[model samples]
Structure formats: C-alpha cells, structure tokens
Target: MAVARHVADTVLFEGYVLYPYRASATKNRLRWQFGVLVPPSWTAVAEEHDFQRTELLMEPRRGATLALETRFLHAGRRTVQRALPDGGFETVPELRLDDRVLVPWDEGHEEQVRLTVAVDELAGPGVVVPFTRPAAETTEPVTDKAGRVVGRLVRRREEISGVLRIVTGELDGPYTTRRLSVVVENTSDWTPAEDAGRDAALSRSLVAAHTLLCLDAGRFLSLTDPPEWAGGEVARCRNLHTWPVPAGEPGTEDLVLSSPIILEDHPSIAPESPGALYDATEIDEILALRTAALTDEEKREARGTDDRAAAVIDLADSLPAEVLERLHGAVRGLREVTTSGTPRTPAPAAGMPDLGPAAPWAGAGGADGAPRPDTPWWDPGADASVDPAHDHVLVGGRPVRAGSRVVLRPRLRHTDAQDLFLDGRRALVEAVLHDVDGGVHIAVTVEDDPGADIRREQGRYLYFQPDEVDVADPGEAS
Candidate 1:
C-alpha cells in the first residue's frame, strides 16, 4: 500500500479503487453521510419557480441512480426555515430533473444556498450515512415533561464535513424525468488505513460531528420543554421582528427574517464554532418562533383577519399545489431521485463524488399564502393513508400506483357565473381526494367555498379535497 495523497474536497482510496468501510456490528463509530447540502440562499429560488428535492437511499452496492421530482410553490405552502435569522416561510420544491433538460438551482435563481447531505446510517457505514446536522426540516423533536427523549417526533441528526460537493441537473416538464449518471469514476492509489488523518475534509467533518454529539448530550439534559439554547437573563420579546418578502403582495410569503438576535457570548457555554448555536433544549421554542413570524407575515398579507392564530389557519387552507408536487414522485414515489437531482453522497473512497440536487434552493416565493375560510376544528381531517402494517390503497376508490397521476376536481358552488368563469378561463387546478362513505368527500377550502372540506396534519394524511374548484392533469410547471 502506498502513502495516501489526500484530495482537497473528496475521498481518496489507494490508487482510485478504495476499499469500503467495513461493517461495524460490535461498537459505534463516528456517524457519516454521503449526501451534499445546498447553501441557505437556494430556498428563495426553490420556492418561487418551484423545484423538487430527491432523497437518495444508498443500496448495499457502491452507487445508485436517482431521479428529480417536479414542483411549484404557490401561496399556501408552510415550509419554513428558522436558522435564517428572520424566520420566514420556506419551501421544499421538488424540481423535475432527469438526464436531459437538467438545470442547477443557481441557473435561474441565484442566492445564498447550502445543501445538507441526507442519509440514514442507523446500523453502521452501509446501514446509515452520517451527515444530517443542517437538515432544513420545519419542525424539531422535543423532550417530555419528565425530561427524557420521548416518541412524539422522530429526528435523527447525522454529521458530515462542512465542505460539500456541487452536482447540478435539468428538469423539463412532461413524461419522463431523467438522471445524470457519473460515466467516469475516479481511481485512487493510497493504502487503506485503520485510522484516517485530519485533512480539511476530515477537519470540517469532525467539527460537525463534535457539534452534533454535544447537541445530543445537551438535549438529553434539557430542562425546558420549549428548549432555549442559551438562558440567563429573560430577554424582552419586544425587539424581535420579522423580514417581509421582497414584494408586498397581499398574500406573498416571507423567505428570510430581518430581525436581530443578540448572540450574547457566554464563556460558560462552549460553542463548537463561532455563532454555531444549537437550541437542543427544546424544539418547540423554535417552532413557536417560526409560527409567530409566519403569523406576522400573514397579517401583512391582509388576506383575511388580523388574529395570528386565525391567520395561520386560514393560510393553510389553500396550500400551493407546487409544494405537494415536490414531495410526490412519479414512478417509484421516492420524492424525485434523479442522478443530478438526488442528494450527493460521498462514496467511501476519494473520487466517488455526489453533489445532492440543488433544485429547491432555486427561488423564493416562500409560503405566505392568501387567507381563506378554514375547515372547522371539528373536522377529523384526512385519514392516515400509510400504516406500516397495511398496504397502499386507492384514494377515493381511484386506482393509483407508484406511477399513478390522480387529477382532482373540487365541487364548486352551483352558479352560472362560476360555471362560465371556469369554462372561459380553463385554468388548471387540483385538490386532494380520498374515499369516504361511497362517494368521494371533496374537501372545500376557498374564500367563497361553502362545502369545501379538508384537514391538514403532520404524518397523518396524504390526500386533500379542494372545494368549489376543478382538477386537471398536472401540467408542465410554468
């Protein structure tokens, strides 16, 4: 085995063909992730034009091909980002990406961005990929009243190197979404070592690892259900403000926060890096902050009432169809995993490069939607379509499979003007539908809708029914 020569931003093996990390069944080793993260700036682009995110699952084999999903974020999407100082509505657009017509997130919408690699390495190297710290999920896990890691939310954070790779792809509408396969794989010439040295990549990765483990330890010892990363003097909430969207549209969403958070330095608390703060004490605090900020934005939209609670509820009534599209896959229903669109995963050896898809970070129309009449709280909401013990069933008695495309047609108010308007405009619209007591209970949730019905919750329902509208085949995202 020759002395290994390190690559600047990649993994290298002895002479290109590196040996994979052996399985770890006995003890736990440093968790690792092969995925790459786009920077924070990409959110705006992702939300505005609409893009998709494809999560790649590494097989036991060295590599796999993934496709990108298509998406378009309209007014009501709730995807939010708290890390951005000014809490604002964010998005998780699933851009249609394939082998041809491939595009990068920055191509049309360039802004600050970060792409976090995603993988589940529960067992070991093959079973799980470490990187997960910078995940942009809107919600976070919390502790129980007794101060133990409870089972309300399932959040797994894996750490990886700070420096990430960049992989771009194209997404043309219609028929097939292709992938960009790495035709040329690199070879290394270094000998495998029981211990790897601390190179730049290794250094960044270690920093992330230390931060996460410390966060875990801290969260484990949290004293607040709504955790606060730092607590000393009770700071006044008066100055905490929000950042409005670029345009002052009555119902546009906020993509960033313009407020100032006093990062008071505390020698007592050791930070992994400068300004690297993790409020592991509780995830609810962040959620609350996000909600408040979103509320302020909704009020600014003036689409309806001024009450924060009512505003948020009304905002969710007509979520942008683009947001749903991002999470749905065409064939495998795997959230659009195209070769270029999928998250970049680091192959064990140097040269196996993967830059996770950068679609979602393309634009910013982040989701501050127009307000509308909300479904009554009494509504049971959409039924959980997925159960580990059960199999996939057709929604609303409508046959569906991995590749099924279900067009929705909401039940509109019986009116000559409404019929004439729909017929003259001929616009595309869709609402979710699920079977009930025989006929489909088309949910209604529009400003003037009287019979619209649909309930929204996390991880519980998959279908929604928009009332007093129409459903057409998903067309090419404009």
Candidate 2:
C-alpha cells in the first residue's frame, strides 16, 4: 500500500505547478487540469464532467472483503488584505512585510474518505457512501518586526459534496470472477450565477479525484493483459474517464489504483526523483537544474506563491552533489558481457563478428585481436556481408525483399493514429533493416501515392515489423 501511495500522490499533484513554479507564469494561471469533477450545474455551460466511472474485474474467495479510499483536493481562495491607516482593511493582491511576501492564490486542500465493505453485501443494490466537507474561513494577522499589524491573510473554502457508489455482479463464465464498478460523482448542490466563471466552479469541484481499492482475500485481474479465458469478460468492463490498473509492488494483485491518468501496471516512482515538482512528465534532472538557475527575484516570487512551490525552491537550493549526480541518469536490465568475450545472448549473424571484451572503438583489435582501423564500427560500409538494398525478410513463409509488394496492416498498439489510415494499402518494399536491438524492420512506399518516387529518392519510407504487413499478390511483385 505504501508503494502504491507514492504513485497515487504523483498523479494527485500532476500539473499542480509547471516549470518556474511562479504564479506569474502564464501556464500556471490555468491549474487543476486533471481529474476535475465540477458541479452538475456547470456541466451544461462548460461541457465539463461531474462524475467519473471505473470498472474492473476481481476474483474473490469466500468471505472476501474490499476496502475503498477516495482522495481529492478541495480548492480554496486565499486573499491578501492590507491594513488601513484608520481601522478598515482593503483587499490587495500582494502584501509584503520585511522579507516575506504574500500573494492571493487558489490553494488546494487534500481530502480523503475511506470505507470497508463485505463482498456479499455488494450483490444487489450495492452500497452508497455520501461524504461532505463544510465550508470555513480563517484569517491570519501579518505583523512587521515592530510588532505592528501590517496586513492580514484571509482564506475561505466553499462547501464540497460528493458520493461514491460501488456495485458488483457475478460474471457468467467458467471462472469464478466478478465485475466491480465504482463511480465517483460530485453531488454539490451549489449552482453558479449567469456570469459565474471557472473560479466559482472550481471552489466547489473535486480536483484531482482518484480511488484506491484493497482486497482482503481476492485478486484483481489486469485489464491490459488478461488471461485467455477471461479476455471476453475483461473486454466487457467499461471504464470511463478513469483507468483501473494493478498497484502496489510488482506481482501484488491485492491492491488496485483507478486513476484519471493512464498508467502501466505496478507503476512506481523513480529512485532518483528528489521530490514532487508537480509536472511529473518533465525530466527531474532537467527541472532541478533549471530551477536551480532561477533568479533571486524569481525564487522569491515562487516561494510566495504557495507552500508547495516554496518547498520546491528549497529542495532545488539544498540538493547535495551526490544526489544531483544520481539524478543525471541510471540504466537497468542490461545483461553483463562475460569476461571470456562472449555475450549471454546469442552472437550476431556469421558476418558480423563480436567485438569481444573491449568496445570496437576502444583502440583494441577486433574479436580476433587483429588491428583494423580502415573500417570503424559505426560505418556501415565496414560490414561487407550486410546490404540493405538487397536484404530480404520472411513474411507468411514468403520472401519479401526490395521491389516486392505488400499490404500494410499497422498494429493498433504500436502504430500512431495516423498510421491506421495506411491499413490495407498496397506498398512497395524499399529495403529491409535491422536495429542494434536485433529487431527487423521493413521499409516501404505507398504504391498508389503520387510522391512515392520523390519520397524514395529522398531516402524516406514508412517502416513496420514483418507482422504488421502482408505479402501482396505474386503478380504484383516487381
């Protein structure tokens, strides 16, 4: 559960702040872009959603029970008020006292609701858990070094309401599995005025909403890659706005995280990550280095923006040399080459000799220990046995080489959306290539395309694996 929490936290605060972390940044103006559940009244005007649905397959044993935890952020408006000379205070965007600065901003408050239910109880109407958080306001007097009231900070939160509904149904199949569905909806009754803007809606919305499920005696199946027997059942599960994936440590199926962001099974944080920068998609090393280079004024503004932003500035300033080095990069899963000059995996084809214990550019001799400088490893001309112009690959037990015709069948998972348009299109094989990873690729040009010759002359062609293409009619081969 701890490991899963780390990933969930990352998803929760993703895009909470962008690079620079300053409130003045244009990109930071529009926040809370992920997993937002606005009120039902605003749905019609804004085309935004008020609910999120998550469905998953679970196999439970006798007396199996499930625990669910719903987490989100409650937004609040923070305004800075300046002390008047007489007695009244006026609203101000920024207030400063000594070295500290305060700015008006929308802050997020973390909220969580948890409940445990027995598997047997979810058979009929299931269960409904209604939760609400009341609105509140607080004020903090900001005083200068002279102990005189200089200004004050006012924070106000709007009432938030939501509901979590869970239901289960027995799957009709040979396997004893059941489909569990959970829906999180914002039931706040507040309706905005005619001219109410996004700020008004955000105050009552559930920001960054997500759910975590833990089973006491059951295992959750993987929707991305399910067993052959349960493939049909898994396909029928309808997940909307959110995706359910296996969580916790690798190989642990007792916990599940349904998040608005799509993630692979068993997602974990990188060890080199120092802390949350809010923008999870950016490289940490780059963000840290860039953050460390901010100007003094920029850093000050960032710190005064929000507490989280201040923490980020402090982290960048205090990172140790050793920790910064670790953030540079780390590689994993590469097999170690044996000292006897043989790789654990199979050697390359007969013509391409292994480079032995030393790298080809190490100034050492070839695998046979004979000096050869004219043909460097990087130059393709160094290998006389390999020629892409005449190379051939087997497809459907038929040889497919240069000038051969084929029909494209790009895979949905591996190919982009635009590549789907090329499906069933006839193409002329231009060449066969092999990557350093030993994967084969077939380059082709659309046969009916008017610019086929121009593209071929420019040395540009669409590439695909053998399985993604089928041999055309023998008569069509040139």
Candidate 3:
C-alpha cells in the first residue's frame, strides 16, 4: 500500500525530521504533503482545476510503458543568496532601479523559454534506457504597482511531458528488480525584476515532481507490509503524518506519487566514511549520552573512540569477516555494559490506580484474610461500570462519563493511527460509547484541539480502550 508508506513516513519524520524538533517551531507544526495529491494548477482556486492523472499501460509477464506528464505554473524571478551568521544562507530577490530612463517605460513583458529534462535511476544496471524531451516554454510580463510594465518574465506555462517504457522481456526475471523514480527538472534559469514574479522553475521550484512508478503491480511489495529490514523504517513512516484528499476532489489515482523507498544503508569502507551518520541511529555517541553520567574518558570509550562500531555498521561489506566480527563484539559489549548500568522503573498500566489501604472503598479483602461484604464498589463517575472482574470494560480504574478527563495511550499493535494519539496528552471525555460486545469506548477531544477537530457531531473523536488512558487529576487538568 503506497498509502501506508506515506502514512508511516509521516510518523517517522514527525517532529524529529525537522531541525529543532520542538512543537513551537512553526515549520514543524503542519503536515506538509503526506498522502497529498496536488493538481497541476494548485495555485488557482481548487474548483478551477481538474485532477492530474498518469497512466501505466502494464501487461502480465510483459513489461509496461508509463508516461510522466507534469504541468505546473512557472514564474520568473531574479534572486541571490545572502549568508547568515549561523553558517546558512537565505534567498533574497535581486532588486534594482533604472536611472537612465528619461520617460516612463514599461519593462514588463512575456516570452517563451525552453526546458530540458533529466531522467534518473529509472531502471536497473544495463537495462531500461530512459530519455526526455525539452519542454515548450512561454512568458508573461512583470508590471509595477502603478500598472507600468517593468520587465518581461518568461514562463513555461504549459505541460512538459516525458515517457518511460519498461522492457521486462529483456530482464531475466518476470519483473523489474528495482523501484524507479522519474525526476523532472527545469534546466533553464530565467531572470526578471522583483515585480515580474520568480522564474517558473527556480523561483517556484526547478524540479516539478519526481514520480515513483512500480512495474508489475502484483509482483511489487506493499508499503503496509514491509520486510524485516524495512520494519523500523515502516514504523517510523507510519508515525509521520498524512493528509486526506479534499472530499470532492479526484481520488489518488489521478495524482502523481513520489514516496520514499525504505532501503538498508550500505556499509562504509573506512571509519570516517561519508555514511557514518547512518550508524548513528543504532550505535554512536548518542548511545553514550543515553546512558548515565560519565566522565569524558568514559564517554569517549562508550562512543568507541576508534569509530570501530560505526565502521562495522557502515562498512560491513568492505571489511574482513573476522574484523567485522570483532567490531560487532565490541559494540555488543558496550551496549550490554551501558544498558546494564542504566536505572529504570516499570511504568504502571493505564487506568490502574495505586490505591493504598486507607481508602473507604478498598477491594473486598480487608486487613484480615476474610472478605468484607460491607465494602462499597469504587465509583469513578457516571455512565460507566467498574467491576473488578471485568477490567476490560472499565476506564481509568473507574467508570467514565461525559466531561471526565482522560489521557491517550493507544497500543502500538492495535491501531495504525495509534501514533496520532499523543501519548500522555489529556483530553476531555465526550462520551462513554458501548459496542455490540459490551466493550467500552471513550470518546475524547484532545486538549490541544479546543475547537474540536474531531467532535461528537461526526461520531468521531480519539476513541480508545479503557486501558489506553488514566484519569486526570481534577485540579491539575483545571
């Protein structure tokens, strides 16, 4: 399921992908383009444009031919980059004024420009030759605020098309061995005054779209069911974010797709290889930091000052088998040592209260071994039942009702959107719903969504099992 991959990538990159993963960063606040199918004319009103579609003319046992047709608005702009103190640069539009003009002259005009295309990694080694044709361009004029023409801005106002024909007949197997990405790049750079708008390719963007096409759809792998090497990648992708198509918009079939291919990182050949960062995830200086306080020497030791762990992880294929084994052993030893020394406590299950003995409604067994019949059942709230025998049907170690505050703790194995449920975030209980099996489902409005993005009117909320949340303290929630 390409859709699942989109969803997982949304999760994996959420918060962490953007620099400074804090929620306060406005850049990380919105889901960019996961599961989004933008029409060719995205800048105009949504109703004015029809959904763009790509056709895959595929046949069984034989290779299929696919066409990538990308159409986008190309504006022209003259810009330059200025360096920042943080060692990065920001793009600034180049602005200049003409003093030689004695009379008012209109510089704004429109013209046509040509675009070249480049196709990348479309086929396996020695197979599937791919080519692209130059795009037919057009131009428009840049006008001043007073309606005086300042300069002519060239625009590639039409579709730039490309075709890729897959020859499965030449391959040894029934299908192509690798996934391919079709990148459409606008090679031409157009310059115009600030009032004319930016270049269609560079200003708006040079690379219009990169389409991912899978040959022999039935033989392809599903993003929803990734293999073991890709499991962690898949999980992270799910945790990313996704956007649904507008209600009346054309379906995904009518959109270009570019999804990340979950591939295993290749091993590095040396300790200081370029891909050393790839090893940082599973083993690196971060591992030492995760452990308890350590002196500088200990931290360096934990980081494998020699970079043996990183080399082994990144350059596994290039090293001798025995040498690789030694590096692996060293890493394993460090992991064991660091993890063994770390202190941790078991987290209590959701909805289970730590009720000390002095409570008025303690369980039946009193100080003595005999059962106490007079003990009253704990009353959590209205619209719920708290039977000890059926913990499954209870919420927050007590019953739940409208207006109760609960936390979200969806299980990983149960729901795909479990990642969407912000763990430990308090939500107001909207209702205690029951299913045919008499199972309890608590409807909750996330505290962050005071406007109620998911509300009772839609029969929607972050519904969860009783064990998924604990009761919030009244004073604290208030």
- Candidate with best TM-score: 2
Give the local distance difference test score of model 1.
0.22
TM-score for each of the candidates: 0.15, 0.73, 0.26
List clashing residue pairs in candidate 2.
none
Least lDDT summed over 10 consecutive residues: which range in candidate 1? 209-218
lDDT of each: 0.22, 0.85, 0.35
Q: lDDT of model 1 at residue 47?
A: 26
Q: Candidate 3: deviation at residue 187, Å?
A: 7.2
Q: lDDT: which is higher, 1 or 2?
A: 2
| Clashes per candidate (backbone, < 3 Å) | 83, 0, 33
C-alpha RMSD values across all candidates: 29.0, 10.4, 25.5
Q: List ranges where model 3 is wrong by over 4 Å.
A: 1-60, 70-73, 78-201, 204-208, 212-222, 225-256, 259-478
